[model samples]
Target: MQICVIGCGYVGLVTAVCFAEMGNSVTCIDSNVERISMLQEGRSPIFEPGIEVLLSSNIRGGRLCFSATLDDGALRGAEVVFIAVGTPSAEDGSADISQILSVANELAHKLTQPAIVVCKSTAPVGTACRVQNILDQHCASLQRIGLHRVVSNPEFLKEGAALNDFMRPDRIVIGTDDNQAQQVMHQLYEPFVRNHDRILFMSRRAAEMTKYAANAFLATKISFINEMAAFCDEFAVDVEQVRKGIGADQRIGHHFIYAGCGYGGSCFPKDIRAILHMAGEHNRRMPILEAVEARNQEQKTWPFRALQDQLGEDLSGLTVTIWGLSFKPGTDDIRDAPSRTLIESLLIAGAQIKAFDPIAADNIKRCYPHAVKTGQLQLVDEPYDALQGADALVLVTEWKQFRQPNFSLMRSLMRNPLLLDGRNQYEPALVEREGFVYVGVGRPSTQPVAAALRAVV
Candidate 1:
């Protein structure tokens, strides 16, 4: 199949490369000349695990190409045109469909032959119908070309693990009333679903809602667990044991059940806001989701508040250490990361920070250049380096390396020997026996009187 993928961002690039790897001729189109040029040279503009190697191999094999002009290459005779452009959040929390609309107009003018335009980007419920209307209007104005079909085929790819997710999705969702569009989409994705046929065909609106619902539910789980962790802290109960007790049920699996600082990154924050906005448009109120959003925001500050209660209002001249920068492990994305909130709050209180992440230090440095310039913020090469001479340590991300570290070494390096586990990644009693004041989310601390006093006041 000849395929054209518009907007060569993370989703578009990965989808194009993966399709090309499956022997489909793919041309990734982007308006940015520099980005297209970089792709054309067999270089990836973003950092993904196996993207560069796969892209170079497919491009060299003549199955993948990059272009700035959509009309010249695969778009001319493509069987499937994927609209993978970004739909960032608008001021009202709904998606800004301007990019998708603009691309629909462009593709309408250039699409001389009949094709199926798949909405691979996460969009609102009726966005496919809107794209269809836009394309229909454009075709009518042209007076020469026939109308194309729009299919809602939202992507579920996660950053840092996108290649694997695309290659082997848990399920493939295609929502279309047109039989021809559905068949073409199935053929395009047939290779990936061969092992276990997980293609779910449904109405276009339902498919769109599925993506948003999945994200909202996952965010709800995170926020729910976080709330439970807070309650466990108040009542001197172990949140982990409580989680195990509930997660043992077949209905509630253990995934995303661990209490953490909060949920962040690209999906949960934006999708939850979009769904809430959509509910408001329909004159509906989702109080539970509203609480989920509120809890997540407050949860990000738990670590900082814990440290403040331990040390008092005067955090000036304190050297704090941070373990992770990205929202979670295995990715370099720092969008809405909890560490950013904690670091900013600590910095405002006149405290110094030494932070380290296996992958996200450079990305964090890009966002905080002034912190890097001054000695107030230090990005260390190794996790232990972050603990050197620090007064307290906070684990923002539960990376594998951070899951099991040398606690004795940590105790030896820290000046004040305070450990605040934001993710609750360690056993509190075991950590305390290593000669440090260990604090975990929902863990019973030896000295909760200070925290309780702070909460009361």
Candidate 2:
């Protein structure tokens, strides 16, 4: 199958490259000339694990191509056209469908033959119908071509592991009414669903709602665990133990239950807001999702407040080291990262930050240029470099490097021997044994209690 994926953002590029890898000729279209040029030279515009390898191989084999104009490439002979443009959040928290609409209008003008237009972007319900209407109007204006089918096929690819998710999806949802469109989409995705026929066929509206619902449910789980962590803090109970107790049950089944500094990324924050806005449009109040959004905002400040309680109000000359910058590991995306919130709050209280990440440092510097200029936000090359001359350490993202470091070196480099474990990455007793003040989310330092318990035993 020949495919054209519009909008070479994260989703579009990954979808196009992965499809090309699966023996399909793919042409990825983007308006950005520089980005398309980079892809033409066999370089990925974004950083995703195993993507460059796949992209380079496909380009070498003449399977994948890039272009600024869609009309000249796969759009002419494409069997499946994927609209993978971005639908960012609007002022009212609704998804701004302007980009998707623009692509739909463009596709309507260029596509002369019959093509299955698939919505691979996260959009509101009834968007496919709107696209169909746009295409219908375009065809009526031209008075030369017949109608085509528009289908909703939302993607569920995570940032870091997008290639794997695309190649081996857990399930593929195809929402279309036309039998011909359904058959074409099913055949296109057959290679991926060979292990099991996990292709779910449903109404267009249901498929759109499913994408939002999945993200909303996952966001709810994260916010629920974060609120529970707060309760555990008030009662002096360990949330880790609480998580273990509940996660042991097959019903609960731990996945997003780990308590940390809320949830932040490209998807969760935007999708939750978009759903809330959609509910409001229907004059319905989503009280649960509203609370979930509020809780996540507050959770981002947990580490800042913890540090204030330990270090007092005046942190005028304190040098604090932040271990992670990206929202999660394996990618350099800092869209709504918790580390950004923490850094902003700490800087307002007059504390300098020495932050390090494997990939996100350069991007973080772009956001906080003043911090770079004023010598306040120092982007260190290595994790230990951030610890040098630091007063305390705060672990934000659970990167592999920060999981187990030389505690002895950490103790020696810091002005105060304090460790704030944001993701509960270290054992309380282990850090305490190294003669450092260890603070976890819901667990108190075990040094004092461990000695007494050991004597009793």
Clash pairs (backbone) in predicted model 2: none
Which window of 10 residues has the lowest lDDT sum in candidate 1?
A: 446-455
Provide the clash count, candidate 1. 0
For each candidate in turn, the TM-score is 0.94, 0.96
Clashes of each: 0, 0
Residues 228-300 of candidate 1: C-alpha lDDT, one tens digit per residue? 9989888677899999999999899999888988998877888888999999999999998999999999999
The global C-alpha lDDT for each of the candidates, from Candidate 1 onward, is 0.89, 0.89
What are the runs in model 2 whose C-alpha is more than 4 Å off?
144-146, 446-457
| Residue 316 CA displacement from its true place in model 1, Å | 2.1
| Candidate 1: C-alpha lDDT | 0.89
Error of 2 at 53 (Å): 0.5
